[model samples]
Target chain A: MTNLPQNEANDPFVDFSDVALRYGDENGTLALSGVDLSIKKGQFAAIVGPSGCGKSSFMKLATGLCPATEGSIRVAGAPVTGPLKITGMAFQNPTLLPWRDTLRNVMLPLEIVQPHRSRLRAEYAKYVAQAKTILATVGLAGFEDKHPWMLSGGMQQRVSLCRSLIHEPQLLMLDEPFAALDAFTREELWSVLQDLWLEKQFTCILVTHDLREAAYLADVIFVMSARPGRVISTHRVDIPRPRTIESTFDPAFVEIVQKIRAEIAQVRKESKAPARPAAQEQVQ
Target chain B: MKAKHRKLAEKLAPWVVIAGLFTIWQAAIFIFNPRPFILPSPALVYQSFIDYRDPIMAHALFTLTNTLIGFGLGILVGAMLGIFIGSSRLIYAGFYPLLIGINSVPKAAVVPLLVIWLGIGQPPAIATAFLLSFFPIAVNVAAGLATVEPELEDVLRSLGASKLDVLTKVSLPRSLPYFFASLKVAVTLAFVGAVISETLASNDGIGYLMLQAASQFRTSLMFAGLLVIAAMGIGTYLICAFIEVRMTGWATRKQTQVTGGG
Candidate 1:
């Protein structure tokens, strides 16, 4: 515990250096390439890009769901070769096991990750108490016994968030977690997510198509080009803590969103051209 | 009150339909005055049922036992094969078509081949039942496992869940509703397979009784045997449905909630 701060300061929690992922044999879909980026310890990073820019693919690579065909990825100063135990991910869909109620769904990670998995049965009461607390944080206090199908999409996603955080993972990966929700629900979840992240300060990476969402939640936003997705640019947000819906209207926030939107639009336009961009094509 | 009334109506609907069918059969027999050999009246069938109750009970018991045994074996072998085929793309690719090919060759057609290999009597009946019942279970279980959402797999996989963990914790549980569904279908199919084999070659059983009655021109007794088989099929189907409702209630609950205005 005493050496934790120093350990955190020395290395990026997630480091992708010249990473490339090809799906199949030699002539495969090159989903991601030259994805060199790093999230500093406890930083909230958002990745925004055009459709099919491999944003989800990047999440897969960082989480070690699949191995990069080229280059090295290091998380916490160690190379990532397989699925990392220190990370938890929430996808666009809630993906909650319909059979399990909210409390059990939230407790899913506990059954899979860590010393927790071994200890869960013995410390069952303690874990259940912990899960209840997490669910309350996500505004799901009274919905514990309800199955996912019984819950609204937003509530289900909240349950998914609680599940992802239940293991208290060091890194949280969210790939368009609120993309499927209605606008109101999406905004509500953005705040719910923001509060959770603020409370824990886990090193986070969000892959999303929503620019305003990226601008509102992320400390730094990475913009990527289309197709053989590459980080085209990076922007730092200097917004104050506890940024709200009002903050989204602030000129600085709006400007940041507009800039990202322009960048993505440009990328989309470039992708439409028959000729692939030279800069992105050249391997780093 | 309204919900309770609806529930009552649902339960009575099947009984009413059955009674109506019996009434229609009786009327048709009375009007046409066909020979009992062609189509026995409900009363005649009932009389035959009482007259031959002893033999009928014995033979019905034999057929039911064979069906149960074969169905049980089908569950085991089919579940194993389903898990095997489902867990690996390679095996699924190689064996799915072969399974389809085998399943497509009617169980009735296979009964003769089963008789040659296992000789006659209970062995052939049970083998035929086992053969007929296993295919659907295997296919359904495999489909259940195969159709597990990729994103859901990612959620577990990212947690460092082992392959076995994924199968046990998610895949197997997810496939339960499918397994039960297949059980409902397979149970009925197993009955058919057993009865078919029994008819073709057997000393005793409902099928044999029906065959004997037909040969002796005891058409009412043959009709009684058919009625017994029908009752057994419905009974087994109901039992399967009851168990399915109990075990995979979550799947059904989801569907109901969806229809009840989301």
Candidate 2:
């Protein structure tokens, strides 16, 4: 027991070892298998993969929304038994509560996560200030009182990002948070996210199919194989901080994106032969 | 500006239609000169309204009070049961069939049982109204909770929100529009239940007055009783509509563009 504690203490912020997830019953199809990975505290990591490669399942496992069928997963040095309190998540849809204005939506996590939850009513103004500051950080400062429907798509996503970070969780999980936006808005949000990450330094795991997004935002990129998905290769982005849209066209950035794309293409080819039957079954 | 004018026009349109209807009714009565018992003229009905104003008002007030009390209790019990059944699939499966069976039995049949159990008065009227109105509230509330976006639920659940917290904070608020919409249906049904009980077992209320008027050949008084009931129904419906709009203005704002022509 002492040895186990010591080992956990030395582990990274997020550590997944030989993790395999099978959906539904025991005989269910394996979504992911043999996934060993780790991320240092405060690091930004992105998982890029082809569609249907179980990238989302990896996120679900990390957040404890879905349990792993086999192997151990630890986050912040504690084994995940159920949904973790010290994590935040944003999705592609920017699912802000339609009834709540921007500020109220941002303050939602505070109403759920503790010790903030217990103190929220007594310290309501203090929490509102915190939410406003986060909203301002994401360029949603003046729109705090507007309902989600009143805002544009990019603005809604910014509010969503603020809501996810309001409680200041140790880990931030984003599942293609910018995929729904136009290219211009997507790039703008990338920088907004980068700035937020620079200021907060929370560990992030973004799952996306957008290679340029993975290249621009992540410190280290993990390219996933076709399902049953695994981290097939890792690419470190050693670009200096404050990198912008101009930097995305840099030779090094282009090369890293091309390399990952080639690897994904290779995985697709290998998995193609087996996937046909599954595709047919799905159609039927 | 255009939208505001259109809304005003919509509000006035119903009154214009009612006036036109009354004109045609009075004209037809003048032309045909039917017997008062067969069909009273609008003038005679107006005379009855003036003569029996006190009795009509009293009976109307009594019916309204019973309907309001029954409606309030129905909302409370129905909302509780709805939240309970909606939150868990097991409970929903167990209770839904039982609820449907209860709702299928005619509330008229239940009124006699209520009279047998509670005697012939406000209790039976209230019970009948409650039985008629509660089903819609229960069903709508459950449907509202059931239709909550899975993404929204996931966001809350992943934050370690308890089941109760999710229901109170998210599900309940999301269900407001549906709840209020069901109230419109429920309020009308509640009137039906109240009048049914009043006609069968109660000595008070517009239904009883109408029954008495019918026996005495006071056809104009019976028509007057019906008009009073209709006016009261409209009044309560307007109150419900006002509350619904105030509580769920956000939902309405989004769909306002689709609400042209009324």
TM-score, one value per model = 0.95, 0.92
Itemize residue pairs with steric clashes in candidate 2. none
lDDT of 2 by residue, A1-284 (tens): 11235555445889999999999898898999988888977889999988988999999999998899999999877899998888899999988888899899999999999899899999999999999888888888789899998899999999999999999888899999999999999999999999999998888999999999999999999887778988877889988888899989999999999988888887787787754332111100
Residue A202 displacement (Å), model 1: 0.7
Give the per-residue lDDT of model 1 (tens digit) for B73-134. 99999999999999999999999999999998887788788888998889999998999999
DockQ of each: 0.86, 0.77
- DockQ for candidate 1, please give it: 0.86
lDDT of 1 by residue, A1-284 (tens): 21356746857778999989999999999998888888898899999998899999898889899899999999877999899888889989989998898999899888888789999999999999999999899888999998887789889999999999999888899999999999999998899999999998898999999999999999999999988999988899999989899999999999989877877788888888898665443222
Candidate 1: chain B TM-score equals 0.95
Q: Which candidate number has the best DockQ?
A: 1
lDDT (Cα, 0-100) at A140 in candidate 2: 80
Tell me the docking grade of candidate 2. Answer: medium
